[model samples]
Target: MVKRLGLFVIGFSLIVVIIQVAIPSADGRFEQADATPEKRPFLIVAGLDSLTNGALTHKTKSRYLDTLIPQMHKTYGDGGPGYVPFDSIYFKQDHHQLKMSRRLKEINDLEPGQYPSQYSFDLKGLYTNKGRSDWLRFDLKKDWTYGRVFYLQQPDGGSFKIGYRHQKFIQVDTGGSLSLKTIELPKHVQDRQVVIRHISGKVTLFGGIFLKNGGVAVSRIGQGGDLLRWHAQLNNAFMKQWLQQLKPDLLIFNGGTNDRYRSSVGEFRRHLRHYLKPFEASKCQILINAPNAVKYKQKRLLNFIHSMKAYAKQHNDAFISNQKVLGNTFQEAQQAGYMGDWVHPNHRGTKKIGNQLFFYIREHVLPSYKKEHAGF
Candidate 1:
């Protein structure tokens, strides 16, 4: 009887095991949202200088974007809501091959604040417009938690209250709400991209409030190379240590503007080559962006940049001309009168330039780069 009972139990258990294997789990999510199955190891940003940073951006009022902040979660999977979204603001391609990159790493052994792309690195001055009332909206100003801000004094002398499409608990320099008497903004607006128009065109221009947020973010090292290459000790050890920590996927050499504002051809190429040596060691694709020379100091900078571009192409490595876009914006600036100083943009100018730069990278630059290297 015991043997018979044991046999029955064994058969029943076998049936139960079979039933479980045939049934699927209760949760319906079959694919992971934050993934492509595999991930890249690391990226390094090389060759950063001051003008490479905006020449006159106010550091006190601007927030730097951490491109890695979003990616951090992908590796650890524990940052806020989830992994950092490469956001693909532009990366969309069905096919690509991993070509051997010709980039290099700089400052392998240095200290912090020494590197231009470091989190601590900031612009030289606030290159912003004054006496201008118009403001351009970047991303819809909803859910803005915190960030730096700037404004104009208005022709009539009333305080300019920066406006937002939608927001809450968002604070500026001193944690104060904007004056409702002058500015007007929607309570909850959501714009996938930035858009703007003249307040003179509307009489009631929307106020702008630059807010701060935390996520995977990145910023172009603005234009500061003017004083930086001349002042920054280039390869000081502090700069190298910073690179080790930040390890950016790409470091853009958005310079040659200051270089083009040169006294002679030798001086221009000298500085350009000086940066290249250390940069070659950084292991990042070096994009030698030439400056679309404006009449800086009465110098036709665009022409000089054009010459350097030809030189870059001679090597057949990796350098492209961005002068066209820069030139177009400059022409637009001239037509709009936003080039108030005939140089740096005013509030209206900054927004337009910023959006233009952002879009160029999004549309032109990002498409050429695939998020993954399939053939490698």
Candidate 2:
């Protein structure tokens, strides 16, 4: 009887081992990223704070990140709902259902549209129509749980009347020369149309409309003519104010395209270190992206890219080089009609960059990060 019981126990132990070998760990099949949502949350902080209004609508922002997110999930697994920190900026070129009349300047002076996530709006035109009743009209794309509009007041700035569907109107008095003013949106029962009419002074610039959302939040954070200095200039107080709310576990830094002439290789590395100083206590894993190839400034740009690669290596952080993955020249992209100018790539170029980054993270970054940190 004792011999028979021992044999049965051995057989059961063997079955358990086979089951363990067949099934994946609790985190899921991919060892690339932490699929366990509650453990590690991903956050993408792209573009510049001043450039946040590039894509005003949710749909447009989704277009910018569509390639990256799904591919990220396929490769790294959905790490759950991502977090977006700031929401006071977004701009969509065509708010599909809205109607507009009157001549408005479609200027990309800010060239905010250079970033796929950015939607450069008619700021000067909006500011110019001071006395006109028909300034600008657009239907809200979605019901925002809460919303806000950021505006810049020039020295001559006076006032503007804002109304929602002709229901409620408010006159915002801008004291002359006020740099910036934030208008709090009223809590709405449903999605509605809004109109802006000039009341007094020139509302020279607008940060754009911002809305709240759940799921992966891809933020645009680049400013034209900006180097890495803008990173330190961001509202750190505000960021820390809602750090808990953001709950970010991974922060990806993608810049230096605008910094080709701004810094030498040594300064580039120093600036990167300075930019990262603020987040030292945040405990989020940082990743850096090398700049994409631009037609001019070939040698200086290459030096900057090399510096970024070195920084990523020395610091042991994940680094993805756009120049390496997307090719050394913009010839292919330009031929494909991706270049908007000598410097920036349009939407098509943006999509290609996203795809390349996705594959790199999937094949190289993920596996290495998992081995070092177990998951992130």
Candidate 3:
């Protein structure tokens, strides 16, 4: 009997060792393995609405994107804020680390009798500095190794000086005619702050990008009152160029609150397909998120949700219904204190929704993705 008990103990110890060796760690790495883990940055592009733009939320931290960003960092590592636009009039970006100070003039790309498709580059949101002293300073909180500046070189374009850490500035001349230009930072340079000084002529700034060595990058592209169909208003060439550059791992389409009263089910379907057309060639994962329940126009919202779910199913895309997380009905959500007004959610509601979304992605989405990509 003593000999048998000792043998059993030894067998269990071997099983424990085998289990530890086979299973990957919480950081997505195998134990005692030399094979480098997936270090490539996982980029998530979210095209949402006011819920993500922080228009209805009283506090900046209460925004869903704010909650999602930190949670994603905890798991996938921090890749720094992905994209930072120049204008804050419509879209409220949450890059507290980077600060800009200058009297910049905002320009809309929409031209009379001409759609965005006619434009060769992105002109939707632009900031111009005509003054020689006019400067847009970037104060970064963390040390970043990679950065890029997006701008348009036009006939009236001027020169701008880019300096690192208050050092000597490098002057770039925006060449004549309309075209897109990208300024990439030297890979060896570790940057803390960047300043764009207006040298001469008109310097039109589109936006900027900041990234770390590895991990996940979540870029929030949202406006206060944007609809999915409004993507049509964006320049197709610019859209393709940006997507090719971004090369997102996952693309999330979130909108419907503004369209609930205005769009029909058929129109919404067409709009979603139109928005997704550019991404089909990329072969990246797509996630369609239904908007939260509202007080009025509940039927219209439900119809939109149903259409979105069906479309996602048809296209083999992932879908999450906010109604499931918040409440199935308007009254249910209101009673649960998730609804702030007839159309939007309060701070508490957004926090709850955001946390739930994080959980869902970590638990369900990531597992399926790993399995599909053979432990990617």
Candidate 4:
């Protein structure tokens, strides 16, 4: 009996060791794991205005993302660009290769009663292509085994074809009620150009294309002149579905620039909470990033920042203030060559902002995450 008990204990210890070796750590380390990189850590930065689009100062690459993304890849393996917006109104796609047969009509206006709104009816970050032969091609900068295409299914929605390399195109029908849909490619795709071709109907694309393989991925979801309340107008179910699909390990909300004058403190808080409710049950960490200092509405912007800080504290989440790095006042930032105008940051200014965020993650976020997920 004593010998049997000892053997049982030894077997249990071996099982535990095997489990640990099979699982990947939150910091993206794995031992004796499969070659497939499906469970890589993902970060999403969702913001408004300049955070969504670029600053007034023209540039070849994004202001902060160009600096931040490369740094992150160096530290935690390369995971392809997280989200690529289809709209090119104010955003330039320079990180990857993209070719469109023809420019798609960008849509921002929403019909009356389509959504709950008090001031704006624009859909913000959605684009549609109606031409039957129109096609968009995306060539990834890095190798990725997984990809997903996000779009909206509306009453007048049409069909489209998605294919990669020499494989057959998959036809997707979007003739249904208004809702969000995704075409996820789980198969391995390496160094191949992905194409989306319009077949017959009008297809509205949202949240762009998501590509990742392993390691760390940082995605952005921003719309010029976006407000916290505007996000509240989206269907709760739709938002929840989208969040589940993205499955971000860290979600950052960057706002207040556009919301300062438009919404009162209480109103902003309410809208923010409503917008975040879908993520309440998610295991992903939350970060609230306050907008940088602006020349106008200093008092109102400060109020919004304070509210966001308090909310972050109450939720036990991380908070980063752009003012801490950019400057306390608009004049100070302007003098430092950070301001492209009264509100937007110049190229140099954006680089500073990106570096600061990367430092914060290295100093504060990663350490805590490593501690919490130490064993696996």
Best by TM-score: 3
lDDT of each: 0.30, 0.44, 0.58, 0.59
Sort by lDDT, top down from the best: 4, 3, 2, 1
**TM-score of each model, paired residue for residue:** 0.39, 0.50, 0.76, 0.75
Clashing pairs in 3: none
Per-residue lDDT over 1-376 for candidate 1, one digit per residue giving the tens place of the 0 to 100 score: 0101000000000000000001112353222111111333223232233222222334211111222223333332321221111111100110111111112111111232232212122211111122243434344212322222222112332222233333211111211222111111222223333222222211221112222222222333322223223323243232333333333445445444444343355555555555444444444445554433244532445545655576567543355443343345456545664443444434444344334444444555444444444321
- Name the better of 1 and 2 by TM-score: 2
User: In candidate 3, what are the lDDT values of residues 1-376, reduced to their tens digit?
Assistant: 0101000000000000000012234565533322112344567766556666645336322246667878988887887666655554433244344334455654433441142122322223344546565777665544455666666666877877765664445567775766556665443254446777764666666665567756677766645555555554455545556666556677766777677666788887777776676666565678777777777777877888888899888888889877787898878888988776766667777777688778877886677666655423
TM-score: which is higher, 3 or 4?
3
For every model shown, the clashing-pair count is 53, 15, 0, 1
lDDT of 2 at 43: 50
| Model 1: lDDT to the true structure | 0.30
**lDDT over C-alpha atoms for residue 15 of model 4:** 3
In model 3, how large is the Cα lDDT of residue 102? 52
Instruction: Give the residue spans of candidate 3 off by over 4 A.
Output: 1-39, 56-62, 89-103, 108-124, 129-133, 141-143, 176-178, 187-191, 367-376
Write one digit per residue (lDDT tens) for candidate 4, span 1-376.
0101000000000000001112234564533323234555555544444454543336312246667778988987677666655544433534566566654544444431143111111243344445566777767655666556666666877877776756556667776776666665535556777777764656665534354555567765544455566566655566566566566667667776776767898998887787667666566677777777888888988898898899899888789887888899989888887877776776777788788878877787777766755431
How displaced is residue 328 in candidate 4, in Å? 1.9
Q: Model 2, stretches more than 4 Å misplaced?
A: 1-42, 48-66, 69-214, 235-245, 330-340, 346-348, 360-376
